[model samples]
Target: MEKESGSMKSSSQTRTEGSKEFEFTARDFERVRALIYKKAGIALAESKQEMVYSRLARRLRATGISSFVTYLDRLEQGSGETEEWEAFTNALTTNLTSFFRESHHFPILAEHLKKVKEPIEIWCSAASTGEEPYSIAMTACEAFNTLTPPVRIIATDIDTNVLNTGANGVYSIDRLDKMSPERARRFFLRGKGAREGQVRVRPELRQMISFKQVNLLADNWGVSGPFDVIFCRNVMIYFDKPTQGKILDRFAPLMKPDGLLFAGHSENFLYVCDEFKLRGKTVYELDPDRKTSSAKLRRA
Candidate 1:
């Protein structure tokens, strides 16, 4: 699915002006691009200069640092407060998600559920705001025809702020506007009186998922795998080919032989990774012919 990076103005022209609150130069933006890539594996484009300035400016304001260079120097030197790095990373990360985004994938997942054994494990690799993982939980419920399905979903994201939101499992009522009224009534508890227009996911759905902060680029993701399904949708587009390949290599080892990998509608893993073969629309399964470690382990 195409990600929307809301309206942006070019930073090229803004560089010539002197009206900005913070002194954000081309080099500052470059430093940010480098640091984030090293820390999180995101490849920021030159066109994102404007977006960078706007997002990081809030950090400057919060930290009471008047200049981008000084703030960046602190981060680069690792002298800033321990939480500042978390804050900086959070400021730059973009999260755009809705319930059952890429609707086609959910039905595919539902069918896959029937074929798999009980006590299935799923990893929602980019569980922004909990919508995607909750959708998975809901799908599991529907597949088994029960509110308490034999499923466990581990929802992860790099941004701690969103992970916290997801763990809360609350959202504005409008987020479910597109869903069938029956589905909405079954899965969510509507807010009343003072809490009207807000809804919280049913406890059963919340219990099915565990939200955590995970940096995909790290040597250790801190999550044990061999997951039956891994939903890494709309995430690879943020990475360059090399980073994408590395992540995919890591993914293969953590998956069961027949486990399915669901990617974004727009992502194509066919050329980037040899461990998997395209199984359906942006869906991938371990390539039996590839002789990857995971496949070999499964056969052995």
Candidate 2:
């Protein structure tokens, strides 16, 4: 018993303090590759085997692990490996988000939200760093002030790191440069001198949005929503056709009638037949709302 305890303690110590020249065995690559794909739909090519190791190298070093295999073992054994997985996902997942990233959609949103003249509920399906949701809030501030209820934004992201940033509601000035000066002045409060040049979205606007974790591919979303608008922008491009189609199919029931769906500029109903009308790239009004048969989108 004493010998077993001693050996375990030594193992834990070494695992906590990792070594240099971390070697990721083929088995490690296989395990992580499938894990990423299964969870996030990120398909890693054979060439990317070293890319994972290279990216994880910094993480291993930060945790004092010098060898890839050692850090890999640490990941398997550590109680906090969930956070490590988040770090890995953040490193690997493409985060191409910015405020008002695809400007075209905002005017449509403004017009639609204003037209509804009802309690507004919007979803930023891949809210990322909260910029997209904040942009939505700002647009609402300018567009729907006279409405009976202010806009309600639900900002969700699978990436916990970005969601945490989103919850913080603070961002660099550069992130806000694309925002209109008047809107920026109205919605953003400048960070103090020590944190100079940084800006934080006003609490009123930030409070209007709820940030939560949601894996779109999961069996159950655990979200209570049939959102009036779903801005699932830029997140679907990583998926293959079957995956994209299935996602849209599943997402339809989660939307309200007359609600709009916004995909990224690069995504569309090209092969995603049946459920949507080809209103335009990045825009699809829910088919059920189409008063005319002509509004129905065709299979390509």
Please, what are the lDDT tens digits per residue for candidate 1 over residues 1-300? 123322223454455556788778889999999999998899999999999999999998998999999999999898446699999889888899999899989899999999988779899999989999999999999999999999999999999999999999989999999999999999999999998999999999999999988899888788876789999999899999999998998888788777999999899999999999998998999998763577443210
Q: Which ranges in model 2 have alpha carbons more than 4 Å from their true place?
A: 1-20, 24-30, 45-51, 63-81, 146-149, 289-300
Q: What tens digits encode model 2's per-residue C-alpha lDDT throughout 1-300?
A: 999999999999777445536667778788777767776776677788767877777788777867666665665567476778677677767667888888888888888887764677788889988889988887887786731237788888888889999999988988877677887888888988897989998888877888988877877766655567888888887777777887787666666667788888888765675667766657997675433432332221
Which residue pairs clash in candidate 2? 18-64, 18-65, 18-66, 19-65, 19-66, 19-67, 20-66, 22-67, 22-68, 23-68
- Per-candidate TM-score against the hidden true structure: 0.92, 0.80
The best candidate by TM-score is 1
lDDT against the true structure, each candidate: 0.90, 0.76
lDDT of 1: 0.90
| RMSD in order of candidates | 6.5, 10.0
